[model samples]
Target: MGDHAPDGEPPPPEVEPAGRVITTDGLTKDYGAVLALDSLDIVVGEGVTGLVGANGAGKSTLIKILLGLLAPTRGRATVLGLDIAQHGEAIRRQVGYMPEHECLPPDVSASDFVNHLAQMSGLPRAAARERTADVLRHVGLAEERYRPMGGYSTGMKQRAKLAQALVHDPRLVFLDEPTNGLDPAARDDMLELVQRIGHDFGIAVLVTSHLLGELERVSDHVVILDSGRLLRSSATTEFLDSTGTLLIEVVGETGTQDRMGQALAAAGLPCWPQGHLIAVDTTRATTDRDVHDVIRDTACDLGVGLARLQADHRRIEDVFREGGDHVLPTS
Candidate 1:
């Protein structure tokens, strides 16, 4: 028997299954002649998993397919152990979604909008109203919940959208570019809220972003896509781990960084000046001759004060620029 009931029949009772929250196998989608998603096989567990890619990398397409808003050309997927092909409605009932584009009505107040959505999710009138208020407060829109959405700032509008998604008390949320058009502070606030949703409320979150580095702080795992293909998927810690490069900062006159770079290079250490700091290649450094000791001695010889020295960690972008087994072909 399938996970869901037959067509036109009511779905089976919703149940939270153990382990992976989402899994896809050989998922492919083509928009006419253009392939939007290639053969993608991924497993997403609990916590915040960041979906990262450049534009037109199939991030949105995958989200739509998972939500049952669009059908895949090939392969299958399951959310919370319910087949998306057979249990879309059941899956949607247990999951929340925040779309990338603006879909809010201009004249409606946030409170009313959220309340209506909560009721649609099967909450009673009183329960819907209470949830609306609770989610609005949680999203930092309690003070502006009564105002028309048209009058709300960009941050407020984003928060209102988030509030509606959470009003239903979903086990998972798919947030597509939740930090779209906000200032740095607002973006940080949104990220913090996303972290809270995953950590505090225990809601599994799948957040999409084109900006590679923005999700590093909040996401427990990251999935990278390139031109409709999976590039890499791993724990965020693995991406940010030390890259065997030592970042050395010297405190001295304006010419200090260049001088240190020259000294280190002359001392047989591969080093380069990197915007006020010098980066020393430590991949070849041996335990008998520590890279840190070499740097310290070089700085002392040049009479430059060492400001800071630490291992340079890799960023998500490095996986693209630096050739790695995890990287996919751009062509």
Candidate 2:
């Protein structure tokens, strides 16, 4: 009746195993009159995929549905070749989830809590303990593993949460706001750790955040959501490619940028002042003479030193302001 195959039957292989790690089709969720997720579709491949959106953008709701903790009102999803509708328990066993908010008990030590969770994931007692130790060390919490989590700092608590998520040695990890409340240095450390989990450990990661720029450094692909609707999903490099605009900076007198803008405008180029630099729209340039040559010659004619000239790339936030219509299918 829905886009998914019948329960107990596997969905047709929409993509090669090496290409996609997860897929969803027409996934929607509603709370009475309010729709948390509108008929959405997406594909996540191997490596670190950043899911970005502002607060109350249904990012948390999507994670819960993927983990099988919350049911979608329509559509279906698959994770690691298992149906979320029929094999949620099996899926949870193979996948690990690090929730957004704090969930640690004040009375328990990090080591013990992580160990218990590993065992609950079906690991033997001895294996769980060993795995817990390895994960704690990897997360850089070896020294404080035995201390009460109540006294731990925010960064330390976040590390503990990450340790538990890795204790089970899951094939894929869903990290929800793993860097929340972290300072700049701590956030960088967390991001580096996330990169290692995907690169060094050969595990797939789906990390979420409201910050747009932070994930650009670490994510292989990005999926942006707005009001529970898909905005854009593509490889990180695709978003950073040239947007037909070049930013030019000149060094000379105090108003060097202004001088360059005026010279370029007089040369029949569409140029304007932007802060200390001038933005030149290259879309109008003639094919015979490249835009770069035009800019360089114009600068030479004006006798102003060209400090920097490069194409202006699009940022993730541009998707919202530009109302991006590019949506990649789950298949």
Candidate 3:
């Protein structure tokens, strides 16, 4: 379900859930004079929603409160229609969490740790072992499932953590910085695993990370937080729309970059040099249909071999900087 708030404001109290999987009402938390979370209200749909913010943006505090690890100083919350206050245990039973920090025992193997977690979630001994094997393989830890976690690389250790989270076959999972400290390839693999956990397994995912751009490729929706308040929340497509700014790519040395910019300017296209790229301001590029043609003509006129040309899509970070107002307002 999606938010029904007019002008992007927080949905009203009387607004019924349109298949909303999670909701918070006037949630607040304070650490003495420090307000960790304001009167925050939010609605989460039934797919992967990325929680993005810098450190101390109340991301961790919000997670703790939702998980029932921290009680709100004011207001209330519900997950899967289960009140966090009254159904903490029941909520936890169906929700799996992969913490940002390392929590595995050095002496234990991935198989051992996952099996134990599965049993803790109330799976029987034999079933826990069987489920553990499936989860480990799903996270791509087949060969090293029996090896001690202490010897595992950061990537391997992360996979083990993910395995344990999936051992119980949760309906929803929270992954905190699952790609932290991994190389590019490993990060991509982890992202693919996360995508499958949400789409293929039909499980809801609420993943958090300090890096905003990283979630763009995988998340179905994104929630931006700042200073313990809701900054923005919207479908990924809203932020990734490329209907604005002109994207231009030219071939040649750095000198070609300047030549292209000068050529576009001579033709009255409001353009600027953005590192190796040239960004044309489409706010006044004749018309939307003519923008691409203008870029192509300018590039050819400069004798600059064009490599790529298209509308510039806003990155995740761009949306955050502009607040949700640029795409959708905060009601």
Pitting candidate 1 against candidate 2, the one with the higher lDDT is: 1
Candidate 3, 167-252: lDDT as tens digits: 88888888988988999899889988898998999889988877777787889999887778888888999988875687688998
TM-score of each: 0.81, 0.79, 0.78
The C-alpha stretches of model 1 lying farther than 4 A from their native spots are 1-18, 248-278, 286-309, 323-331
Number of the top TM-score candidate: 1
Q: Give the least accurate 10-residue stretch of model 2, judged by summed lDDT.
A: 322-331
Give the candidate order by descending TM-score: 1, 2, 3
Q: Which of candidates 2 and 3 is the stronger one according to TM-score? A: 2
For residue 182, model 1's alpha carbon misses the true position, in angstroms, by 2.1
Considering lDDT, which of the candidate structures 1 and 3 is the better prediction for this target? 1
**All models, RMSD in angstroms:** 4.7, 6.1, 7.9
Comparing 1 and 2 on TM-score, the stronger one: 1
Per-residue alpha-carbon lDDT of candidate 1 for residues 199-248, written as tens digits (9 for 90 to 100):
99999999998887788789999998878888889999998889888888
lDDT of each structure? 0.86, 0.85, 0.81
Looking at candidate 3, the ten consecutive residues that score lowest on lDDT are: 1-10
Candidate 1 collision pairs: none
